[model samples]
Target chain A: MTIKEKSEAIVEEFAIFDDWMDKYAHLIELGKELPIIDEKYKDESHLISGCQSRVWLHADYVNDNVVYTADSDAVITKGIISLLIRVMSDANPSEIYSSDFTFIDDIGLSTHLSPTRANGLVSMVKQMKLYAKALYLRAEK
Target chain B: MGFKINSIRNDFPVLSTKVNGKQLVYLDNGATTHKPMQVIDRISNYYMTENSNVHRASYNLSHIATDLFENSRKFIANFINAASYREIIFTKGTTESVNLVASGFSDIITEGDEIIITVMEHHSNFVPWQQLCKKNKATLRFLSVLKDGTIDLSELLAMINSKTKLISITHISNVLGTINPVKKISEIAHNNGVPVFVDGAQAIAHANVDVSEIDCDFYCFSGHKAYGPMGIGVLYGKEEWLNRLSPYQYGGEMISSVNFKSTTFNELPYKFEAGTPNVAGALGLERSLRYIQDIGLDNIFKYEDDLLQYATKKFENIKGVMIIGNAKSKIPVISLNIEGLHPYDIGILLDQMGIAIRTGNHCAQPLMEALELPGTLRVSMALYNTKEEIDLFADALMKAIDMLT
Candidate 1:
């Protein structure tokens, strides 16, 4: 599915749960299903700073598309990162740079996030886009 | 509970707040405390009528302000049983209090000198000494805590030698809730001819603190933690030490006289206070101290101890709940984690259920490293908290755990 289609699908899935508990349960399930990043990529270099929890994210370009894998010591953070990875991963670099990424707000994730977690989410999105831009520039070179 | 806790809790207006359609169960006392109505009213009264710049102003308002401000220091000095009111120097908070001492002691702390602190100190207590030692070419040594979170007293005594110039330690571990034997520690430091600075930020409100009884050279604590207003803290130094140590900051109100060639500083207390102080905060702090005194420290300690025991038993029985900081002597603070469950997840879930708890390293990253934990969910209680709140917290935590695991 396209990045927008994937975000819409996730939003629709979240809409099924009326209770915060059930939504978190769904998030936890997503966390458990998150594709584990390689042990080598779990180093400090790939770690995102300023998060209350530790999140290690790694991205690589394949056929001009960015493939991202990430992990967090925190289950909720892991679940949240999975959303970003699913939406932006395997998308064209230009598409990632141009995408509005309104699914976070549509799913009411931003409003529910604590200030610290909100910052972490922003950093994750920023990192994903930076990876795409770098790969696009390298492809040009 | 010996005291009328329900009535006492009513004095705190924030206790009646509802979060997410549930009664607010505030358990983040270690971060800061909710002020009583008396304190809030006192602050308002100061701003409304007694509002004026303290000292240097020849007016009725300034006189009233100065009287209230100075009386606040005197009241706090008496509250802590300091040697004299002159020994009490006000600062922004505990951080600034420690920084003042660390900066003032720089002249005496020379190259090859040593400073000793514990592994469980909050960053406020740890960072200043660490940076001072680094800048002064001194070695900063840490007394390791045991697995159960209590500091190794014998080990700390052994570490002190002629090379040790100063010893600064926390009276209570913010994360561990371990109450260190400051009096005993002070005795050892004095025997070694070393001055001791006690960070009483966590201890002052929960228990009675007497600088005279402890015999520590210096004691510092924040007013907010003791149900006072923020931006005001107390630093009690021995008269001799206060006289010998140079002022950390130089500005108005701290100088006796100013000249282009050389400036002479003011006397004790004023020498340390370099600017227009937080007069209203000081007044509010006095009112807070009065409120706590009315409740009585012994009574407060007894009530909180009972609450801790009950909560500890409840949490101990919960499956998958691992209670960290199992110190034999502790206050109501309890840090815990569930097997395979992140602290942030538990904290957020509990907040949704109308309970407030602190998560993460709590500004004690080195302590977290030593304990080998990413972080913990800490439920710290104050005098106002009751057993009912603990039950609600446990119920919410269990539900969160069930949902996650």
Candidate 2:
């Protein structure tokens, strides 16, 4: 899917507004819909720190393309994790390197999070994309 | 389990207010307590009527402010049953207080020394010592908590060695509500020739704390957690240890004689105080303490005890609501996850009903890992909390769980 399509999907996923509770339920539903990663991608190295939730995320290089898979114990976190995997998972190493996550602003995301939580979410995204970038660099060499 | 519920509810403004057009039920006291009417008035009065810098000024306003500030220290010292007023040092909150000790006590941590902590400490207590040990080439040791959430005393006793420098334990586990026997732990640490620093952030609000009874080298707590204003807290250090540990910060008011040649520090308390402190915040804390004392700590404790027992029974009756940290000696807080429901979702749904609860790890990441579960919904209790609030929480939680399932 195109980046615009993926971004729109995320916004649609979070569009529920009955309350923060329903909002989170929808997020967990989004996580439930996350496409599975290949079994080989599950390993020890991809876990994110600073989250009480255990999230293992991995990206792979196939035919000069990157695909991502992630899993989390907490459904709400998993939904965000799914959104993250969709946003930064696939595409070229160069795109991964140069792209900014500025689209999150349009979705009115991060506003609900405290400063620390928002920063932690940023760190999680950064760490994931950096991992994908590493794989891309290795293949190019 | 009932004790003048309606009148007590009115004392806390948050309880009287409506959220999303619904009555507010606050069950997040472990995070922080909602201030009472008197405490609120005291804080407002300070800003409106008595706004002045404290100490070292020879003016009337300064003298009054200084008296208020010092009186606050005496109030808190008396609240905790400390021997003297000089024992209390104010900081931003419990986090800063713990960091102060970790940073200051680094002056004595010889190479190859160790710091003993428990697995259940909030990151505030854990990370500071981890950083300190790492910086000083010392080993950081964690005494483990059992499945029931209580620490194994024998195991911790084994961990203490000649190299063990300090035992820093949380008096009450924020996430689990597990109350550690600090007096016993302090005894063991003292036996091993190591001092103990008790983090009383969660305990001070719920239980009576006598620093002399605990007999530890250092103790720390926050005023916010005890129905007071935020951004101010207390650090109680033994006089000998306070005299021995170097000051963490350097600034005005902390110095005695500074000449062109060199700078000399002031005496105890002021030596660590460093700067002109939060005068109003300190007084507000003093008021909060008096409020607690007036309600009678024993009376409040008994009331909360009834509420927690009622809550536990009420929660257990709800299908698929599983409580965590079933330690025999626990405070009122309860962490539980509904079968197949996320804690955040539950917290959100409940918030819409004008009920406030905490979700996420509650800042005990390591304990979450050990539990092998995601974050749980934490229903923490305060002395002012009633069984009615717990009923509302149970009703909302069940409703949320049903929606999720």
lDDT against the true structure, per candidate, is: 0.91, 0.82
Q: Which ten residues in a row have the lowest lDDT in candidate 2 chain B?
A: B1-10
Scanning candidate 2 chain A in windows of ten residues, the lowest lDDT window is: A108-117
For model 1 chain A, the run of ten residues with the poorest summed lDDT: A109-118
Backbone clashes counted, model 1:
0
Tens digit per residue, CA lDDT, model 2, B341-385: 767656656766778888888999898888876788999998777
User: lDDT tens string, model 1, A69-95?
Assistant: 999988888889888888899999999
Write candidate 2's Cα lDDT for A74-111 as tens digits.
56566777777777766766776677776565556576
Task: For candidate 1, write residues B16-113 as lDDT tens digits.
Answer: 99987889999999999999999999999989888999898898989999998999999999999987999999999999999999999888899999
Measured by C-alpha RMSD in angstroms, how accurate is candidate 2? 3.8
List the candidate 2 regions with Cα displacement exceeding 4 Å.
A1-30, A44-70, A77-141, B1-3, B339-342
lDDT of 2 at A27: 69
